[model samples]
Structures are given as structure tokens and as C-alpha cells.
Target: MTSAYWPLADLRIRSGPLELRPPVPAEYEVLADAAAREPHAHPRIPFLEHTADTPLRRGRRTLQWLWSDQGTWRPDQWSLTLAVFDQGQLVGVQNVRAAEFARTREVRTGVWVFQDRRGQGIGAHSRRALLHLIFDGLGARRAQYRAAASNQASLALARSLGYAEDLAPLTADDTVRHFSLTADCWRTRTDPVSTHVTGLAPALFMFGIGHE
Candidate 1:
């Protein structure tokens, strides 16, 4: 996709101490290096055999998948994957995706932080920024998220952000927990909010929203 085709170009969000934006091509290596150094950054997601040692390759692959034209770009089937920055350095990745989305208007979010950055409240702030992007900027009706059953940190983050528990089926691994959130519920929370969102109107239109 051309730079102009990137829907989230120039979009940004801040929550307390974090900023979230689309990853520049030049920053991919930085993001990859951070991930390579911290496999525990995302405790719930399992690492593939080549993932820990080959983060640059993994980062490239993720970019390719996100930008692929063959993949559905409808509001429901698309994901806006962003790099999380702390004081201008790449530290993590966050994603908001829809499944069976056209009919549901519901999105799911996931996030990861560098190993060294844990306990600094970066994850929580980054996630809140993404929520604003989806619920306010993108006009999404609701959002959902899941964490591994054993990922206490993720569960805590979800609860802290007002995501209610949902009964999900047992995964093959039996370690996943599901959570859901509504826009109204999120708006009621009193978290600090900061963001710079540009091109959101165009991006939302590209995703099928007629009026922002």
C-alpha cells in the first residue's frame, strides 16, 4: 500500500505516558529488536520456533499481512496495527481487529510491551489510547479482548479498563480468557486521555463509515 493508503497515517493517541501511532517502515527494525529482547512482553501469546530470534523477519511478515490487498479490508475484517512509542522510541505493538465484523461492528484488541518496560503502566495507557481510536475515532459500537487464562497481567489490565468478563469456549490450549467492552462503558471511565488523530475521517470512510 502506498503511504496515502495507510488509513491510520498521522493518527496518534496519548494516555498518561504513552503514544500510539502507525509504525513507520524505518522503525520496524527498532520494534523488532525490542520484541526479540523481550519474549515475555506478551505472556499470553505463544512464540513460534523462529519468532524470538528472528524479530525483524517477524516484523516484516506482520507488515505484509496487514497491508496485503488479498486480505479483506472491510471495516469488520480489517485490523489497524500500530507501534507503541515511549518518549519517541519503539517499545511495543497494539492491534484492533474485527471478525465477522460487517455484521457485528465489534472489534477485538491485543497489545504487547517490551520486557524492560513492564510495570511502568505503559501497557494500560497504550490500550486506552487504542480504545479511543476505535470507539471515538472509528465510530465502533463496541470492543472486545481476550487474554490467556494464566495471563494475570492482561486480565488485570482488561478489568482496569472496564472490560467485563465473557464466557468463551475452552481453547485447545485451554488458557485463553475472553473479555468484552461497550463504548458507553468505556466513556464512563475517568482515565486520562491524550491523542493526536489525523486522517481519521478519511480512514473511517475508507472502512465504510459514511460520516465521522
Candidate 2:
């Protein structure tokens, strides 16, 4: 079980008060609990199952996407979905994903924090830590944010991180507001928080980082 293919299981990203790592089997149940407690932000996203439904189904739905994403991954086009933990509590999940990333030098991320976990700076630095993994760890030239126009929380977080506006389109009536951050711009930001990574070298190679 030890090979270059193992970054999905081993990568870790950490900030002052947050940590990101792929969850094990036991942790998935904890993620389910976090999901049961969360008030999902946008229920319109086709792929997401609504958490406000039945209690029994809530936990089932919460674990489905992660397991499915794991099953569908490929190095050329895949999402590194990490469980977000604060101190020791599972609070949310974060994803850094791409297609033909070695050639494109571009990546996009998705994040979610539970209802109770909102309002702290977790959302900001969590994404920041992912950006660092993209730009600094994986040699990305830029990263994109396609936020729901109706999701003021996501839009505000993107703005606070110094992302610039870009044009994008989401599903019908679900307006997609776009934003982007370049490697250079990422460097100049006043360092609201910094990130450190471990077990990322293998992940970088899986991403075709140095091969390009």
C-alpha cells in the first residue's frame, strides 16, 4: 500500500488552528455527524444531497459523495477531498480539483463549513491553505473560484482572500460569480494566515507537478 499513488491517503495541510487531511473509515462517521448538524448552504447544486431532510438519510447522503469521489478519481483529473478539522473536531471538508492540470497550471477548490463552524476565519484560511498547496506546493500559476452569486458567504470569503473577478456561468438561475488568484497576487496578500504541508511531495508527483 506504499507507492506514489498514496498521496490521497497521506497528504496533510495545516494552519494555526485548522488541519486538512483525508479521513479514514472511522472519521467518515464523524464527518457524517458534522454533516447532520450542518445547514447546507446551497441545496440547488445537482450533485449535493440536502442535509435538511430525514435524519437517517442525512448521514447516508453525507458519506455517499466522498466515497463516490474516491472511486472516480484519476491523477489527470481528480479532486483531493480533505476532511477539515479544528483542534480535534471535524468541522467541514475542502476540495482541490482539476483536469489536465499539468498542462493547464490551473486548479479550482470547493469548501464547506458546518453551520456552527461559520463566522470564524476557518473558511478563509482553509481555502488559503489549499491555495498554498496549489501555488506553492504544486506549482500552479493560478486558481479559480466559481461561487454561487446567492452564496454571500462564499463570495465574501473569495473577496477577502484578494481574488479578482472573472466571468463564469453556473446552472440555470443559479448564477455563478467567478474569481481568480494568481501566484504573484497570492504572494502579496498581507498574510492573514500561513499554511504548512506534509506528505505533499507524493501528491505533487501524482499531480504531475515537476514532470511538466
Candidate 3:
């Protein structure tokens, strides 16, 4: 499972009881199927499941999107869509993305946990793993998150993680709330979730950063 050409495939992050790693093409269908089962998990999210389409079609669209995301990665702008697993079982997907990372050192993240697994704290563990990857492993200065104002669960999670409202420009949709956490806030936090990241040293270049 080693990728000589794309070391990102080797990246792994562990937090609590979860493991987050880069998704392989063969597992795209599994991710899509998970999403298909909970199409309306977040009504405002721009996933294909929101459309009035068959599950198969929605899954197909999800596959295409995942493929496109991996294919379009670049140093200046890229998205790392990691497949989340709990004790070796596919649970969902978590995405952490950045633009002009070399200069801004900021990243944004998104996640989709299946409806059946919503209340079990899986999302929190998944996000803690991702935050560790960006702030600790990648040396990110800030991490941002946005959720529809109506999505109380997501907003509550952001607040719980010590994220504060950010005065960034409003999106076309005013319903989305923005929050950001600075590296100082993250590092000095009293309640830290233990996390470990591996295989990232080899993929540093792909993320537009060098070993510090």
C-alpha cells in the first residue's frame, strides 16, 4: 500500500479510536454508499445526495467528485479527502483543504458521518485527528470551519473545540456560520485530544511545506 509517486497515500492520522487516511480509488464506492444512505444528513451541504436522483446516480456523482478532487490537487490549492475508519470499519469521510497555504497557513475542513453514527462522538474524534494533522503535523497557523446556521450540531462542535467566530467575508448563502481557531489557541488548549500523525514527513512537499 505504498505509493512511490504519491506519498500522500501513505499518510495516516490516529485520534482516540479513529484512523483517518487518504482514500484509495477502490474504496470510492464504499464512501459513496455511506453517503447515499444518509443523503439528507446536512440539507445545505452541496453533496449530490441533495438532488432528486437515484442512489446509484448519487453514488456515481460522489465518485466523480472524489476523483476530480484528487486529480486537481496542486501546491497552491488542494484538498485532502481522507477516509475515516473506526476499528477498521469504514465510517465516513473527512476533508481538509487549503489555498495559498504557503502564505496563509490556513486550512478548512469538512466531514460527513453516516446518520446511524451521528451521536456517538465519532465526528469529534475524526475532527480532532484532522486538526492535529493541520496544526501539528503541517504547521498550520489557523483552521477554519463553516456550517449552516441551522446545523446546530456542527456549530456546537466548533464551539466546543474552542473555535471563535471569524469576520471573514460572507458567502453567497448567509445561512453559513464561519469559525476559526488559531495555532496559539489550539496549542494552549486545556482539553487536548491525544493525536498522532505518521507518513506525513514524506508528503510534506505535496502540501506546499517543507520539514521545519
- TM-score of each candidate structure, all chains considered together: 0.80, 0.85, 0.91
Q: Which tens-of-lDDT digit does each residue in 99-169 have in candidate 1?
A: 66546778878887777887888888888888888888877788878887777888899999999987654
Model 2 per-residue lDDT tens digits across residues 39-123: 5535433224454476556667767867877777776888777888899788888888889998998998788787788898788
Give the local distance difference test score of model 3: 0.82
- Show where candidate 3 strays beyond 4 Å: 39-44, 48-51, 191-193
Tell how far residue 62 is off in model 2, in angstroms.
2.6
Model 3 Cα lDDT, one tens digit per residue, 1-212: 69888888889898767899988878898877876776564653446436466777667777887987889999889988898999988888888899989999999888788778888888887887888888889999999888878888999889888889866646666778899999999887753567889999988988888742
Lowest summed lDDT over 10 consecutive residues: which window, candidate 1? 40-49
Residue pairs with colliding backbones in model 3 are: none
Clashing pairs in 2: none
Alpha-carbon shift of residue 5 in model 2 (angstroms): 5.4
The global C-alpha lDDT for each of the candidates, from Candidate 1 onward, is 0.70, 0.77, 0.82
Candidate 2 TM-score, C-alpha based: 0.85
Cα deviation in Å at residue 40, candidate 1? 4.7
Task: Report the candidate with higher lDDT, 1 versus 3.
Answer: 3
Backbone clash tally for model 1?
A: 3
Q: Largest TM-score belongs to which candidate?
A: 3
